[model samples]
Target: MTEQRLAGKVAIVTGASRGIGRAIAERFGAEGARVVVNYIQGGEGAAAAGTAIEAAGGEALAVQADVSQSAEVRRLVRAALDRFGRVDILVNNAGVMVAKGVLETTEGDWDRTIDVNLKGAYLCSKEVAPVMIRQGAGRIINVSSNSGLYHPSAMRFTEYVVSKAGLNGLTKAMALAFGPQITVNAICPGWIRTDMVEEIDPETQQRILDETALRRWGTPGDIAAAALFLASADADFITGELLIVAGGRGMH
Candidate 1:
């Protein structure tokens, strides 16, 4: 029998009801990890994620918590510890985006975007860090975006770009603070075929495809695989890095 890479591990994935977060939760479970599928909404989808994990012979628990709130994030960590004894991985996948030009965006939209995309990661990481430090090991994988970096697409998304850019900074700061025991990293994915990205206009989508070296949209599974690698022992020495899983987008 082939041994699972994450056997006996515990992972907490926020905003895991759908999209990349859901994919990560399912993939982690299949690798033999006990998963905590966290969702701020989409309760049914979260439940389904847990169910699928269990169906795959892995342990799972679906918990509803908002990562942007400290109390809720603390609750999430507590629940995971209560159920599984220790946390092995934390994928801060909870994020939001408001597609508007800089001048067209509102303050409320900006706040919401930053709260979810950047603050959410901060709160979850803060809560989990103590547990991980006590255990002497852990992984924090931030689901960031290349739009947060030096990409042409960044021009149109002010709030989202700002939030994710902050997230990337947080990734590095957290990595510096949490090491050499805990590894914190970010995965910057390009246009993935999530419901969110599918909403893009056809013209823009085609333009993205043209710029992408792969000439196609990425899958949630692609991000999940990167998460798996970061969460595994193979990445023990790696931290404070931004991995561009964007099918080579922004390369040109």
Candidate 2:
């Protein structure tokens, strides 16, 4: 077995049942972090993720919780503490995407989007921050999106974009609020080839690729690697910063 970088550390990864969150949970487990895989609706996927982590020679526990709910978020955190004793890392990766023009977006759509994406992050961070501050060292990584950084007029996901934008602001705020001990940061991923992206049409997918500097789509592993780096000791001094992983698509 390879040397584990995160040996003896415990991590809580939200929405770890699938996609980018699943990838991050697996990666963290492989690095020797005892992982808490939090999922909302996919019990089977969450169990599978935990099993994979254990198969990789690391520990994992699958928990069900809606991150947007304060009580549920607290329960998730308590469960992690019960299983792992401490949470050295927290990855707020749970989010939702709804594509619609701002003029056509309904209040219900906006509320749901904000609840899952923005409010979820806020609730999870609130529950974990105190624990981290007491521990005197921790990492909080928020999985944001390039859509929040630079909005493309052609793509219509008004609610989703706004939610992510709010997340970016929250990341900075938490970083400042819990500084000198914990480092908080956000990763903005672009066009990752996940189940979410598969929902788009082929022509639209190709257009996204054409815009990227790499002329290709990113994978969940790409974003996972960024999360690992931010959680690691190498990023001890970095905080309140938004790391863009868009393959230069939004840039040019």
Candidate 3:
């Protein structure tokens, strides 16, 4: 039998009920990590993910928490600690997007996007870092986006782009502050084929494929693989870096 890479590790994956977060949680569980599957509203999806993890030879705890709220974030981490004893990995994958241009975006839209995408990461890290620091080692992986970078595509969702840009900055700052014991990093995924992306028109999707060097849409599993690497010992020496798993999108 092949050896498991993350045996005995405990991972908390926020927004893990579906999409990229679910893929990452399942991947980590298959590698033998006890997973805390967090969801905002999809309890059924979270339960299914937990069941899938257990069937794959790892334990799982499905917890619902809105990462944007400090109280809920606290409850999420506390639940993980109470269930698993220690948290070795934190995947701050909970995020939201506001599909509006700058002029069309309201104050509420901006706040919701920034609070969940940027501040939620900050809050989760804040709550978990002490536990990790006390344990002597940990990994914090933020699921950012390539749209955070300077690109024409970012203009479509102005608030979301700003939130992701803030997240990238937070990734670097947290890495510097939590060094020597905990490693912090971010994954900047380009055009992954999630339900959200699948909703786009086929013509637009083909245009994206044409621009991508691989000429294909990246999958949630692709991002999951990157998260696994960042959470494993193989990434111990790597920190404060953005791993772009976008199938060479925007390389032209």
Candidate 4:
């Protein structure tokens, strides 16, 4: 068998019940990292992910916590430390997207989007920062979206776009804040074939494919591979950067 790049490390992945988060958790586990999969509501999904991790000859635990809540974020971090002894990698992958135009977007919608997508990233990172700082080395990866850059007026989702854009800024700020010890970066995915994207209309899907150089939708595995690289020592010098995994669609 090949050597694991993340052997002996522990990683905490938020919103890992399904989709990209789930893929990241499994990938980290495969790389020999003891994984803590954090899910808000989907207990069964999280459990299944943990099971799969164990099946792959890795250690995993499923924990429940809403990232938007400060207390919950603290609890999640503590749970990881309690189970794994330390947190060497943190993947802030919990988020919600609401598709609506600016005028149609309500105050509650805006707040909810920001709470889960942007604020949740902040809370999780804050709770884990001290732990990483004490260790003198760590990795924090934020899952962002390409919408943060293009701002396509044709597509709605104003609140979602705003939250992702803010997350990009947060990624850079945190990277600079904890530099030379802990590396913070963001992965901006363009069109991944997650359940969320499957809900898009056929016309929209075709349009998206047409815009991409690859002419195909991306998979969760693609994003997982990028996350793995960012979490590994291979990317030790990388910080405060946004790696776009958009199948060349978002290229100007």
Candidate 4 runs further than 4 Å off: 151-155
lDDT of 2 by residue, 76-101 (tens): 99999998788999999998886667
RMSD of each: 1.0, 1.2, 1.2, 1.1
Q: Compared with the true structure, what per-residue lDDT tens digits does model 4 show for residues 1-252?
A: 999999999999999999999999999999999999999999999999999999999999999999999999998999899998999999999988776678998999999999999999999999999999999899999999988876473359888888889999999999999887899999999889877666678888888889899988889999999999999989999999999999998774
Tens digit of per-residue lDDT, candidate 1, span 128-151: 999999999999999999998878
Better of 1 and 2 by TM-score: 1
Tens digit of per-residue lDDT, candidate 3, span 1-252 = 788999999999999999999999999999999999999999998999999999998999999999999999999999999998999999999888766678899999999999999999999999999999999999999999988875576568898898888999999999999998999999999898876565666776787788788988898999999999999888989999988888888542
Candidate 3 segments whose C-alpha is farther than 4 A from its true place: none
Give all candidates' CA lDDT scores: 0.92, 0.91, 0.92, 0.92
Q: What is the clash count for each candidate, in the order shown?
A: 0, 0, 0, 0
Model 2 quality (TM-score): 0.97
Supply the global lDDT for candidate 4. Answer: 0.92
Flag clash pairs in model 1: none
TM-score of each: 0.98, 0.97, 0.97, 0.98
Question: Which pairs in model 3 have colliding backbones?
Answer: none
